[model samples]
Target: MSDQSSDASSRPGASLESGEAAGAASGTVPEPVSEGPGRAKAAEEKPARASTRPVPAQNAGPEVPKVPAYLQAQPRPDVWLRGGHQPPPGVLTRLRPPSPPVIGPGTLWSVLATALLSALLLGDGLGANLLIVAVPAALGAFFAARSAARRLRPWTAVWAVGGLALLAIPALREAGWPVFLAVVSALALGSLALHGSRSWPGVLLGSLGLFPSVAAGARWGWRGVRVRADDSRGRVRTAVRTTAVAVVLLIVFGALFASADAAFADLLGDLTPDVSIGDSPWRAFLFAVGLVGALAAAYSAAAPVRWDGITVRPGKARNRAEWALPLIVLNLLFAAFITLQLVVLLGGYDKVLEETGLPLAEYARQGFWQLLWATVLTLLVIALALRWAPRGGPGDRTLVRSVLGALCVLTLVVVASALRRMDLYVDAFGLTRLRISVAAVELWLGVVLVLILAAGVFGARLLPRAIAVSAAAGVLAFGLVSPDGLIAEQNVQRYDADKTIDIDYLKGLSADAVPALNTLPEPLRSCALENFERDLARQEAPWYSSSWGEVRARDILEKHPAQNHGTECYSLGQESDERDGYEEDSYDPY
Candidate 1:
């Protein structure tokens, strides 16, 4: 027995094995030894401590501490564990989930003030009230951003001015839908600009995710209000108290005075707000919209999403020959098309007309929409080519810039061709709203292509924002020009020159066209102005809801009232109601 014990103690790792065996028998956790140079010394010292403890019966091991089952179900620890190992202390508590952002008093006041302003200024239908409400809303956003301690980007000033200009469109135009779209876009741009969003994806999200952000802002604002409610010293609480007191005083005193005298009651009736119970829901809706919009802007400004941090993987670049070949082929095609256009423009149209046996109007109509679509497709092609273009060296960049720049220049020519065709078509078959709107779109597209070419010359870092700005500018220009009015003026001029007019088509125009329509001959004038005058007779817009366009149309109609001559005007039947076949031709691939 002594020899066997001596043999066991003489074995390698004998101390560590005995210590671990002792720990297992005792059910006491063994201390971990330090790795490296200290490990041998620790192993040597461990058995001395183990030997001093009294040996226990196998079944009489020390009691393991009772951990509750709920406590046993702790979070998964980061480090791997061997059999019988416990996680380090406080691991579970350290891994608790973080809380969301806390909204504050300044943000709360900005939201409340903006909501109240919206309730007072924007009742229902838009007018100068749009501009009035916009000013306060913008001011709210400015102050909110300031309160959040966010620095406004220099670009924000441009968007602020642009938003104000877009809001002015509602006051100037009688058209509702266009103005509505402009206002929505303007708001989106303003919100995005507040955050200094730079990427295409960011711009798209800022525009499309606007309502979702509003809801998020509302929740954030509610959290702020709740948090502030707990603190008596909060400014929000003080403001609420003051407002409640003021409301009580006004209700008590105003009622006593209103009941005291009939004259005072009449004066009270005049001085009292015109809001009705029926308008309460709508006004509340507007108030919420204002609150959410301002909150969205402020929240975004404070904690703007790092959208530019998203990395876009460029398409696999082809070798020079592989990349250059397709682009060269495309450039040749564009050159060929441009050559044909130049031929037509340089007075070779006569020969083409003789060969096709079609009149100038037919020739122009057949090709205008096609050219417009081709120009759009060319832009897509250029975008793809740039995406995959080789950037291996200066030679590659030069090749890309040369080829894409040529493509853009050719596209501009195509734009001009499309516009020329529209002009010819309009001259032959009088200008209509569709023709004018398409012309505007084509013009704006031309502007975009020019911008692209400029981007290629300079760095393209700002290309997305520049394109967005151009689109905003185009919409603003389109709205301010009043296409309906322009259409009326152009058609009237065409009628004078060619003794032809689409009076039926003209009759459907809005009151913005009244000044131009009023210049027509007696029966035509009365016929065209019939709807305009009737609308004016029915309109009872209050001062806040009255637009500049409506005011002008009313004055014009009052000066030259319609003679109720639509029946006689219809009998003339000199103008064709078929308008133009552009819609049918739009589907034609050619």
Candidate 2:
């Protein structure tokens, strides 16, 4: 059995001689074999192992290169790599939430709307007025409630209520309490509805919408109370209260105005003429009360009490140009119209001249010849100014400046003429044309110059402030040195001339009669006369018996060689008789 086992082992794997020979040839160390019973059993169960080959060594480098903590933690690139979570780039950096826009005390749209609404309501039928009130009020209330729901501040609501109250107060006085209440309610409700967005601007506009109603209500209320009050004390009290209320209303209304200055000016103009203090023992008391109330209300409403920082900045160049272009065009048109009208009146139609009994051919020829020269001279001056002046040139500036300068000359001339008419100054010329002499023309020219200057200054942007200063200076100079201390006085004269009133007649009237006729003072006598003339012209008198007859009669009498009738009525009494006779003759076939 031993001999047979030896033979089998030596046959292939189990040969000691072959193992020694392999170990000697390979020159490698062998691994130790397991000796435990468990190992011996594992070895018996193990399959024959394959020839082991030498394996190559792997690179001994770090798994990933180490990055700096600062680099890894960078906000931009790191965030980009992770996901799009970084702040956006570009001009978006400038984009931030904006603060609310501030609105002025009064808005123009609101004031205008209120004025229109008031006029329609007061001027139109009662039903229309009522309807107007209802619609606005309903809208205001709806908005107000909505605003409240939206957690808008109560200030908007207060302003709306105050505005409505103001509107209703005047209407109530004028139209009666019922109308006032209805209108007020309507305005309040409408304001509430329209301003539901809780926007200050909307509320402000809504408040403005109620201004006219308030003004009307105040006016009517004050007038009614004044008229009804028998006792001076009561009247005084009412006046005080009314004025106080009006001032309060004005202040409140003013808050809604985008421009405080404009609003104040308007308010003053509206209220000044109506203010009066009664001759009563309670006058001082009432006045005090009114003053206190007005001041308090004004303060509360944030009315600008004083003119600090009231800089009247000149508008942009574009605006100035816009104003200037129109003004220039208007002046040119006016001059043309005047020239044309004069020409026509003098001699365009022979029939017109003959019917009017005017020396049409002769006057036309002479007047046209004189006017042609004057127009040529004026045109020449304008041409020179335009050609040599700056882009918005010296000529343009001079157009306005010269106009203002002309006003000064004109005022002096007018004053001189007035003085002469009052036997204050006598002209060297023996011309009996005392009414509209060269001096009067000069005065008119001066006024035109000032207006032109104002336009130019207001139009130009570069030197707007300077221009405004110049304009203001001109205004001041005119106001102080001119016939009256206001530019309005000059305008009044122009208005009067257009109306065609007799200045002499107005000059002769008593002071008491002057106001009744809505006449200006002695300085503005021409204006009063002009207004009177317009009033007369507008009177629905028979067409043939008025100034038209006088004009015709003057023409015919002047033409008639035998009739010395033109000089027959120089005295006031004689003139009256002549006018009466002319009317009678014209009406009755006597």
Best-performing candidate as measured by TM-score: 1
Per-residue lDDT tens digits for candidate 2, residues 49-80, read 21232211221122343577678885655655
How much does candidate 2 score in TM-score? 0.21
lDDT of 1: 0.75
Candidate 1 versus the native: TM-score? Answer: 0.78
Which digits, one per residue and each the tens of the lDDT, describe model 1 over residues 50-111? 66654435424454657876799966654555544566645212321222256655556656
Report how far residue 391 has shifted in candidate 2, in Å: 14
Model 2 lDDT, full chain set = 0.35
Candidate 1 regions exceeding 4 Å error are 1-53, 56-107, 233-273, 573-590
Worst 10 residues of 1 by lDDT: 91-100
lDDT of 1 at 319: 91
- For each candidate, what is the lDDT? 0.75, 0.35
